[model samples]
Target: MSTDHQESVQELDVRDVDGEPFEQIMNALDSVGESEALRLVNSFEPVPLYDVLSKKGYQYDTEQVADEEWHVTIRPE
Candidate 1:
């Protein structure tokens, strides 16, 4: 419905993060428990990141913001 509602009840913003592998980010989120994990990435290559994170048991959603930047939301399983 609303962005905030969608983010709170359905998602969480991981915030802008850079210079980290998708696997590493997933691993870190895993340790945090089965909550929503968001990753703000500064990479144009979001497909691979999405694939990798999604494969790790996260319901992944991605949005491109600006140049070489994206916001990825992962709901952990």
Candidate 2:
């Protein structure tokens, strides 16, 4: 799906979640628009998030930017 719609991809930098990444990410997901995607920045591979979001009808693509940094782009299926 094209993200050129009215709502652009919403980005959330959760590298500093401090043990509350799930809550932070869930909140961010709440604001995602139908045509928009959620781009998450983290310090590690958020393996659990993939499963959580998958169950919510979202799919993701991940890329490692550094040894300890990753970028995950999530969109509705």
Candidate 3:
């Protein structure tokens, strides 16, 4: 199956993002509503980000949609 399906939640695609996408992700997360989820699309699993978000008391679920595409849904715990 293709990994490019449309997202049903708030999303940010960083595949083409220049520089580090960490700040961009943080910015996107800041705007997430209480009942919403932030989906981060990237070229690979963002393992480092998992630690950062986890320490901040957030929860997430990651799926490797394709060999090069990963989607991480992050939300407040």
Q: Which candidate has the highest TM-score of all? A: 3
Clashing residue pairs for model 1: 14-38
Instruction: Enumerate residue pairs that collide in model 3.
Output: none
Give the per-residue lDDT digits (tens) of candidate 2, residues 4-67: 5465788899987677689888888888877788999999898988889989999899999999
- Tens-digit lDDT track for model 3 on 1-77? 34465534798999999889999999998888766789999999989998999998789999999999999999877
Q: Write one digit per residue (lDDT tens) for candidate 1, span 1-77.
A: 23453333332233444454555665557555453455545456467666666566677667787776667766676
What's model 2's overall lDDT?
0.86
RMSD to the true structure for each prediction, in A, is 4.9, 2.1, 5.9
Best by lDDT: 3
lDDT of each: 0.56, 0.86, 0.88
For model 1, the local distance difference test gives 0.56
Better of 1 and 3 by TM-score: 3
True-vs-predicted CA distance for residue 14, candidate 2, Å: 0.8
Model 1 misses residue 41 by how many Å?
A: 2.1
